[model samples]
Target: MVPNVRSSLPVTGTKPRTSWPRKALLILGFLFALAAIALVAMAVSQNKPLPKNIKYGIVLDAGSSHTNLYVYEWPAEKENDTGVVHQVEVCKVEGLGISGYSQDTEKAGLSLQHCMKRAQEVVPEQQHRETPVYLGATAGMRLLSLQNRSMADRVLSAVEKTLRSSPFNFQGARVISGQEEGAYGWITINYLLGNFKQAFSAFYFVMNFLNLTTEKSPVPLDKATSAVESFCSRPWHEVKAEFPKIKEKYLSEYCFSGTYILSLLENGYGFTMEKWQNIQFLGKIGSSDAGWTLGYMLNLTNMIPAEKPPTRPLSHASYVGLMVFCSLVLVAVLLLSWLTFHKPKCLQKGLI
Candidate 1:
């Protein structure tokens, strides 16, 4: 009976226990991945500071084709003149741009007034026009017909009359070249990047040498930029273009400088572009090159539409995917082992 038991032992099939170290290692690897992702998520979240109100802003985007009023406001304490800007809303009117400025000055002024009227509803009463409104006139304003010009003057005069009579003051209007406008947009974004809000912050004080300020600053030429109609997702620009400020040159320049897509990149994400006959990496921006400069600029404009958030946190999906893959691998291993371990017995027993 003892000999028969020993012989039967050779025929017995059993799975050996897996190494404890292997199981521990596998579990530890999964935990490590989760921790890494969470750490990254936390870092990204922390990097985005809450919106600050360095100060309020209002813009009159005047093109030869049309005109529109853009209003933005923020908390007084959190933001500075150049800090993170929180946009309230953009209020506009039909036929506001240069058509109002050029073709019909009276209508142009009405459009301007209408834009301001709508903006007044959105901006809070307390933060309301505490400071004077900077009425900046651009190309369309620069090119009005005599009748249109007189109409524009009357419209602005009426606007000034309203401001003087109201709780706020009209700080007089000024015409700026497109270059100055481009510089301002750059400045706004950079201030947010540098974390100093006021136009007169310590950073600017320290960096003013780099700003293009000179005893005789060159003025930008009156050039028309091409339009990138594909970029403007909303019809607001149509309202904007109604005034004729829309120009080919301005559009092209605006497209290159103010790409909403830049807002979407995170610190860890990267892309490659072929430039100067070389494939260049994007993530680790270095020494203020175009890619890195754009990256830093994008860091400030995080609220751009192109920077829309992900549908969900990466953890749940990534972890579940990893688990599925690991489980599939584990099942494959068990199947292979069962087939291998029993192959000899199956053959010997004529069970194959």
Candidate 2:
């Protein structure tokens, strides 16, 4: 017997099948993709380099051991925040600190001339008249003040005369207490760490206002090794009861400096030894030194205002990320719509 064959014809009575919903979806997807592209273009156009108007300040750190002159610069518009001012150059005066010239107090002022001349060279001439210069004599001067008030005053007067004679604006020259030194140093480190934005509580204010913490934090040890091993492994009371002994052989002066720092952190600031271990001591953070000089400059420039400035708009990185994420979502939607609307065509090609 021959194989039977049958022919099938389209049913003309029924309307041709149409998927309006699928077509609509595809049109919406395309429109969404176009909108995403437009948004990306708009964001790209708006992304421009921030205007960089640079400003400068000068500070002479007249310390007990020695004197150092520092030049700092920041964006003119951002002077009201922390970690913005950076030390561009530092000139260390030759010979002893200003206190060494107690007998010949006039020489104390002359000692700073070398560094001031260098400052003139470092900063622009136009900014010289407007740039304020400050002199903060540290522990050495403080001791002199206690020993002989008149001599200390004479030393400050001499330095003030020298600074006034210079082309720059002389703000003032005076001895800063050890407590202020420590507190300012703390501010410098915390600012560099960018911790101010994350935590600003009563403790922060108390530490800032009352404590004399320095910025020269020790390099960050592995937290697990330091805080966890030392504190977590032992009871808090036990750790607090006994202080760790220092065995490393460093400069003899470090003994005094270390004790002074510990006293400042504990007695001066009311921080526990365990809390001290948590603190990081760094010589330099990024490109700037972790010293009180930066804090001093910031104070003069009003970089750290009492009231926080208006919150800034979204950052550049966030803006870029948002654009990219939107673009990806739009592409995915477009692909899904294409697949859905063309199912029949895929089926005809034996692809579905």
Candidate 3:
């Protein structure tokens, strides 16, 4: 009678025990959630894009008129890619071109000190040893070699000595061929204009010879002839007044330069009037001068690869996202399986 009364009365002192399976399910869910969180953290940390590793290069364009020091830089990862390399700085060496220092061969090297120092300042001190510095003498040095091979050698030696003394890795100092100059100029213009990867037609004419007097007149290409003729006919005082900022020496050569360029384009290169319209009189393309310097550096450094680099089918983010999605689906499947296998006995009995 006492036991029957106790069974009928409410259990006051004791609480119902939690099922082991239910506790296990809760712990598994917490663990799976923590695992998912960890997977997400790992994906984010491991797949993030790395910082850019920039590489520097130096090229000295020792032209007939003047010497130009060009500092170029590109990402180390994209060295083989096109349109990535660009000019960062251009320092003009004062006085004259290296060939002009033939009288005092030692001064040819000394003249480069200012620009080389500027390059040192532009590039990091640490990179100096790794940065390759190249000096390519163009028409001036070529002419010097033709006139006097021994003098050209001495001039080159002097400049080489100076470059070797610097912190940079001196590649070489020598006179490049006209064929090389023309080819490199073409490469520079097209490269800077992004023409390598697309369909385009263009021509680049270097007016290096225009500083001297030319017997040929401007060819009739569009308004080029008229413009040059009109400018040349103007009074010297008027010309000076119009271009006050231009140095007298350079201003005086404009007429000759215009005429020589037109003649070269039409006669030397054999371009018709129609083709002349397509010619791009570009001094620069996006801060980079349209010249042989960049092309020269690119060739020596092997920055431009002949073949395209391999690429991944999926982007980094897409790959990571897909992994996370698959992980979540797996977690959901496991949760459903646990629920199906560990259903309450009452519910299972009701189904039966």
Candidate 4:
């Protein structure tokens, strides 16, 4: 039995299993390489501006004093976001506002033709069919509706007909409510200033402070602020009476417009009197005009998305730079590891 034992012994050639730590390191290295490649690709992609698909839209601010046609152009990619729309061109109609044509209601529609034609000139021909044109009559139309419903209807009908006849997609012409006009105006102003959400946060902060504080002095910061806001929210008539230096260059209907604005902030939107001081009543905020035209265009085309867009944790350039640095470190480590573990014994002895 002993004679055959040596010859019958099995010949084996099996590789040893990799240790858990070694396997983990290998996997981590592979992932690092993959991440570096991905970062590089992302950097390259971001470095080049993507082809912009330009979109066009038109909004007619049918205010009491005048009608203004604003042509807005934005990248199609950013259509579903706020503050992306910019007023490319503004065409002011020579005649009175749409409501001014109450007697000759047909002329109200005709007045918009020139503006719409100008819009066509500014917007590309291809976009005309797709471009939506909306007409939002302001205080003038609202007053007209209240005073003479038939005249207001006729004016709106006239404007709608004119818009429909044009090459652009005609949404409709209607008298926007005082609350909507005011709210949209607020949105426009805050959106332009990039303070829409910030304003709301400030309001909440003030409310919390009021709730938390036990001080009941009438002259407290919050009370003083509320008084100032109340003054601002007062109708223009009261303002003019209180401060005689306040001049009216435009139509004398500031009282009506201001009243509606106050209503919008106080009653419609439930903003307390204290918040009125924060709102801008002027025509312009910096270089841009603070009005509802921009907001209207943004809303009509669904430019503002309901959900916030996802943002990358790291910028493309930073990610790529980090990856590159890590890759170099990894290469150096690997080189050092090879030298430490795989160098020939004669070479190691000679180096020592």
Best by lDDT: 3
Clashing pairs in 4: none
Compare candidates 1 and 3 on TM-score and give the better one.
3
Cα displacement (angstroms), candidate 3, residue 321, comes to 9.5
**Over 4 Å off in model 2, which ranges?**
1-51, 79-83, 197-279, 303-352
lDDT of each: 0.44, 0.69, 0.75, 0.68
- Per-residue C-alpha lDDT of model 2 across residues 96-191, encoded as one tens digit per residue: 799989999999999889999999999999889977798999878999999999999999999999999999988899899877887777677667
- Using TM-score as the yardstick, the better of models 1 and 4 is 4
In the range 216-285, model 4's lDDT, one tens digit per residue, is 3212444534544654467777656765643354323343443454455577877665554444324555
lDDT against true structure, model 1: 0.44
Order of all candidates by lDDT, from best down to worst? 3, 2, 4, 1
Question: Could you tell which candidate, 1 or 4, scores higher by lDDT?
Answer: 4
Instruction: Give candidate 3's error at residue 263 in angstroms.
Output: 3.8
> Candidate 3 lDDT, tens digit per residue, 1-352?
2467867887687554568667777766776777677677667766667555667889999987789999998766564454367799999999889998999999999999999999999998988998889889997899999999999999999999999999998989889998888777777867777676422212223232222222243323656666667878999999889779766866787787777767776898888987755454555667888788888777765643333444454577877787777588657858765775678787688755
Off by over 4 Å in 3: 1-34, 75-84, 121-127, 196-222, 230-260, 264-275, 303-352
Kindly list the per-residue Cα lDDT of model 1 for residues 1-352, writing each as its tens digit.
Answer: 2466765566566665568546655665565556556555655654556553334555555555555455554334332222244444555457646434433444545556666777667665665655345556555555543335565676566545544544443556555555565555455444434653422111121112122122233212110111222434436566347536654444444443423222221112342222112211121112221111222222333332222223333466665675566556556555555554456664658642
Report the C-alpha displacement of residue 265, candidate 3, in angstroms.
4.0
lDDT of 2 at 41: 71
Q: How close is candidate 4 to the true structure, as a TM-score?
A: 0.53
